[model samples]
Target chain A: MTDASLNTASTQTGEAGFGDYFALLKPRVMTLVVFTALVGLLAAPVSVHPVVGFAAILFIAVGGGASGALNMWWDADIDAVMKRTARRPIPSGKVTGDEAFAIGMTLSAFAVVFLALATNWVAAGLLAFTIFFYVVIYSMWLKRWTPQNIVIGGAAGAFPPMIGWAAATGTVSIESVLMFALIFMWTPPHFWALALFMRSDYDEAGVPMLTVTHGRRATRVHILVYTILLAALAIGTGFTAVGGPIYLAVAVVLNVMFLIGAVRIWRRDEVMSEADNYAVEKKVFRLSLYYLFAHFGAIALEAGLAPFGFGGW
Target chain B: MSFRQEHELHKRRFGRNLGLGVILAGLVALVFGLTVVKVSNDDFSVETQASGGQN
Candidate 1:
């Protein structure tokens, strides 16, 4: 380290600002949580009081954030080794792991209690289970042990909409389940595509990602298979109660694009990928983000237009 | 001397305090709003309305 760098590090070590603490929440992940949950709430048959709806989404987001903090705390060791996560609060020494744990526990409890008060016990119960599944079942147990980690752990991310539906209607239904299925199936291909390009980070971090354990060829095939399955699910959802003409059109266009991308990924070898810096993988990863957002956005749009008699069939 | 040379540490501390203050204020407003909405809800007043003829 340079003298200037060392001096800066020394001065800033353990001197966390509010942003550092916020970073512990993994705000990017929370965005997906908040959006899905909002879509679920809006699409429900029952109308929620506006304040209660807002509070439900907020507490759900806080619960998601709390789980992220706990994941960072537990994964700090591997995070330090991975280039993608090396600059996280705990790994970078901006925040200690213990502090992260405390914040996570505190926020988790606060979110659950407040969500129950704002909506109902069913929503609160699902929120509490989501945090436990993400932190304990996924982060602590499955992540390091199996290449199937993302496949199962993805369920944790998929629960927000279900919880939101429960919050608004005080019950779970076929519509919410279909929404959950959409996200659940989309995650594997989305993450595996990322693993294709970020090849060394997971390897170095010793995580049993599909790319690291089953090899790149298998990972590619897995992506293709999952994308095909995901396409079927996404398109089929368009026929569900939560779906409509707008959602069907959006799903058709996006799924075709996603399938073509998956086929390209499956056809390319590592040599071809490396020759062009994994262009197809990178493109697919970018498309995955848009794919999910567009799908959910379409669902929300369908719900929004329903009152005007233009949303659903 | 009175200023004590105002370091980066103090600025960060101030920011943390300010952020906490805003979050607490937001929580208070949210709770108050929820109370008003819940109290004024038709469900909450249903019991009062049902007893009015009997009393």
Candidate 2:
């Protein structure tokens, strides 16, 4: 591990600022965590009080941010090497590793304890497990070990909705589990598409991403296979209690578009993808961002309509 | 500024920020403790019985 003082010494001017601290939180990732968790909370069979709902989401976001900070602290070295991550607070010398570690630990404790207080221990336990999984299991262990890192490490990201569902109902159910599976299945395709375009970053960093280890051909095959499985799971979710016409429609459209993109990616050779600067891969990655939000948004819509006769079949 | 002065300034700033963070964390913990007490005292049956009686 790089010493914090060494990092600080390397930057002769300007100490860490507020923005640097916020960057440590990875607000972009936290946004997905908050939105998906909110959907989980809202879609549960029981309704949560507005205050409790707000508090639960807030703490969950904090926990997500804590994981991000801890990840940055641990991956500062690799992050410094990866082009996509070179400008992060720690690597850019705007924040010290010690500061990030302290902040991450403090916020992790705060978020878990407050969430348990606001809702139930089940949700808190899940949140704690998520932080542990991301920081220890994923960042520290799997990231350096194997090409299947994202495949298995995706579980950390998949837990938020389940946590939210547990917060609302104090227990897990098929609906929450299905929500988790949606993200879990989506992770490989989403990230592999990114790895397709940004293959060199993983290569230079020696991170052993699938694109680096198994080659893009195998990664492409994995993406298509996962997309097929994801499409089935996503479409099937529409018939459950949480599903409605709105969710089903969104799922069908998104999955069709997603499958087409995956097929395009799978068919393309390096020459073709490079000819367009991996435009097709980039499009698939961008579409995936909307893909997840739309599915969750549709689920939220279904939950909103459940009070009337219009929601589920 | 001299090197010594700059070092002292950084030290002061770090101390201030750490103190503020600790204070904020303490406040959140206090609120969380209070919320746990309030939630535990809440009566779910009151709402259930009220709705049932009204019906």
Across residues A48-68, which tens digit of lDDT does each residue of candidate 1 receive? 999999999999999999999
| Backbone clashes under 3 angstroms, per model | 0, 0
lDDT tens digits, residue span A1-313, model 2: 3333344345433466556788899999999999999999999998787778888998999999999999999998878777788788888777888999999999999999989988899999999999999999999999999999999999999999999999999999999999999999999999999999987788878898999888889999999999999999999999998898899999999999999999999999899999999999999999999999999999999998888867777
Cα displacement (angstroms), candidate 1, residue A299, comes to: 0.6
- Indicate which candidate wins on TM-score: 1
Which candidate leads in lDDT? 1
TM per model?
0.96, 0.87
Instruction: DockQ for every model, please.
Output: 0.88, 0.14
Number of the top candidate by DockQ? 1
TM-score of chain A of 1: 0.96
Q: List the residue pairs that clash in candidate 1.
A: none
Worst-scoring 10-residue span by lDDT in model 1 chain A: A2-11
